[model samples]
Target: MPPERDQSTNPTGRQKSCARCVKSKRRCDLTQPSCLRCTRQHFTCSYPSRPAFNAIPVAEDNSPMPDSSIDNVASPFDMSLIQGHRNTSVQSRQDTCLLDLDVNAGLESIGILHDLRNTSPMPENQQTIIRSIRVPQAGECRWELTPSSYARISYAIDRMKQAPATMVLENQTPWSHPLLYEDCMPRVLQEAHATCALYLARNETNSAFFARHVIDRVKELTSSPPPTAPLDILARAHALILYQAINAFSGDLQLNAHVCPTFPHLEESIYALYASLQSSETPPSPTLISLYPATTARQAWRAFILRESSQRTLLILCQFMILLHLLQGRSYCFDHACVTSKITTSAHLWNAGSTIEFASAWNEKRHFLVADLDFSEVLEGAGPEDIDVFGRMILVTILGRDDMLGWFAERGGVF
Candidate 1:
């Protein structure tokens, strides 16, 4: 029948489907080298071993197919090509699995295939290296917010919304030094201030332009290579934080969506700057005030300002993230324990306009080095005058308005 269908190649009367198709119970158009179904699906095709008698080579009388016709014709069995195809299929599946796991995790995966190639003796050395790098210790000032406390925090956030614009315009915050417009300020910070000012003063006609400019500026800053100097890094982080605050509070859906993805980059920049500051030879502390000579005192004062600014920025950023999550109806998975860094609570020291003034305030006032998110020390040792705007915000958030007002009343000061 049909001239005795080519029995020299198959030997048996019936053609067998590939092992994979047999397992899946799907029809396989048995094609040698691989089957049609497996080829279309990118699966590894394998066939069962034939008996020794059926493994006989093709007869010399049958002419071999030309190179051009090889793809169309069924080729003779080759073990090397089959093994390679199987290996490739396995690798593809593994890659797909890795991607799926990463997407489900909502964060980067680590240590899954520590040394898939077996190229190193110490498979976990990479992780060990990462662990070796030190970061500043986070504070232990975690707390839960009741509904009233959350309302107070919300009110405080509303008040703080105008603070950024004011800081840029009037140099009001600890981070916005009076000399910010001078040569010492980085170009990026200066531009950020201008952008914030424009955003505050946006009109219907210029709103679209402002949005595009702000989005582009933020992308540039976040995507650029990190600066090597600690001050440069801090400057970039400060600028990004300003943009983040504006976008989050601007009530513009488009702007808010654009900035949400850059939160991680902003956080990394802040932590990197903090680590650099910690490792520096002249880290800020209470003892820094005692450093002698006008030049040394000025240097120390600047260092203190930088460190305090970084700490305050970090605390504000964390609260902003929390606020944004709540607004978006998402549960924030915040690690409250990670906010342990100390903040300078004395308004006099934080508001000092010069090195001499800072030193005078340091000696004259009773400043508290409270944990960034903790207000207990501030309430115990510091009077209302000693607390700055940043400190008051944090205190109100943690203690609620009624308790904070009580603290002010107890200190014989208006809240």
Candidate 2:
């Protein structure tokens, strides 16, 4: 057996490891300021000012990063910069890059990001639910996000940024427009976070694991009390649809084929997202509409946000589904397949502010020429400029997207 090396020779006792090593859960060979590992990788070697906080052994160092690079340090939104040296080993929520837009500002955001790199393997049937730092909601709303889930969430949010976040499809109800304006941002961010873990998963097993986590999260979201309002439905369905789309397009052929068939699960989830959204052909009750109006313009503005947020998400799901089928040269049509036939009924939708405006828009009984008709039927009657149903037709057009939306922008129209 080899003898252990002596540690007494001119030592700085314990060396502070950078957040990267701490996060990576690797041993830090204290090589003065910048460790050998950090130098090799070119990762920013940062030391916290205060004493060690995490269980990992850390050396004491209070020196701050040079002021010139301080602005470019790690943020929760973009951790690529690496967390610069701070007094506290772990950053406070204020300094965290996950700053709230509005909906989650005061509301507790449950669960920290799960590190996918360190996730343990789970069986095919059983899922691993690690930890969720959810808002201190009445205990009923606790959601368990598996470890490394944060990376998934971050991934989804990053992809969602490629397109505009606002735009209602041809739909019938404007009553929820107020909800669309404000609540949409956080909800979508959450959905993005929830699905990214599964969709962008590195392998078949991890992708399945994350997919289960997403389904579990959705189940928890819709459990017990059950969603009572259209806005709630919008939010919940948005997450479901995003998860479904991400799972379907996760781009892992092995996972999609051998491990899990995308068709069965995809159709199942599509039905799940479309579930209870349209219980009846009629619009929601007036009482439900008046139940949560804005108290101030800020409140009203927030409510309006729901329209674009939920609307855009739905549109993306629809368009992305078509885009995928187009890419694969598959013949499965969205309008003919599942619950997409409601787009015509939903086409009466508009950006109405007040409940009265919403009611007016709802009562207009406007018919999108393509509504109640399948893609083939609609395509026959549609003029080049006519807007078809809410999600399907417009998506087909964008399948040939040569930055068509941008071209619309050039023509002073919101595509």
Candidate 3:
């Protein structure tokens, strides 16, 4: 029987040669990326994805034969050991040594795997044998073409690069929540925002898509009944605030430019949310105060972070609601008086290492008693830097209200 072919050898025969060289049967000096022979001739040079099956390892279990036995065996192909022909009938070692010398002459003459060919009239070793024939096997495997690991790492890096920009904080004090997010928020809410930010960072690709991501997150927060966890409510409120802040910045910066029309009601909806107590809905949405319904000092202390985040978010909304009414004659959920009584802190207070520290600090300092929000003081007495987002919205409210007053004054200063 003809000796089995070694599937390890290059099957294309012309794999190392340039396309022109293979066609013309000329020697090719294979080079990387491209070859010299092809470059010099102005022809495209490329290597096959798998140049040869030398890639597959031989069965390590096989023992090597003596040197005297090596020369008689002219081809590595004759050994049924070539992984490709696993189903071929096994033969005595001597019979499989039958390499077709005439078959391998071209590869020998071409110096492909140079050591495989005869250097002298008498060969000294089996390692001296030249590989020539490439067997076509039932099944051949090659490197997988799926997206590489590096691609995922690159994507994660890009998302993080955009994070610090999106997750900005108005106040950097330890008491201030990071990114205006009270650290006590539910992980689900944080993850939702992170997902939105990652998608939003791709704004360069599609501004509408980025806008939709943020819009969708807010929509989830405002579903009919609303979430019940104190942390969840705080997270929802924080998310609403963030959406408006992002919308305001994007509008001013024209980040979307002519590529997209302004997001429809992108932030108007956020102005519409209020803590359940101030909401006056048919049943009211949930709020931190209602969630625990506890009278103990410890529980109150535990609820402080939730209350702070909620108060900050709702109170900020109240100021914006006042501004919108004065400036654009628009109304939303939550009246100006709705959030008038909520307590807030002077510092954001994000420094605590854990919930216990926050509770301990809260019980000790009780900052809200002194720092409680007073909108009248904010509107009449405070300057631009006096408060936070709530304060900024108050300033917008005062300016808008004065503009209305000026319009009336132009018409003889009537009410």
* TM per candidate: 0.60, 0.32, 0.35
* Candidate 1 collision pairs: 138-340, 139-340
- Pick the TM-score winner: 1
Q: Which stretches of candidate 2 lie over 4 Å from their true place?
A: 1-237, 244-262, 272-322, 333-340, 344-349, 353-370, 373-415
Candidate 1, residue 295: how far the Cα is off, in Å: 2.9
| Candidate 3 per-residue C-alpha lDDT over 208-322 given as tens digits, one digit per residue, 9 for 90 to 100 | 6766766666556555354554445555544544544454335423322311122223233232334344453232212222222234433544455445555555544443332
Instruction: Per model, state how many residue pairs clash.
Output: 2, 37, 9
Cα displacement (angstroms), candidate 2, residue 10, comes to 90
Note each model's CA RMSD in angstroms. 20.5, 21.9, 32.0
- Return the top candidate by lDDT: 1
- In order, the Cα lDDT scores of the candidates are 0.55, 0.35, 0.36
Better of 1 and 3 by TM-score: 1
lDDT of 3: 0.36
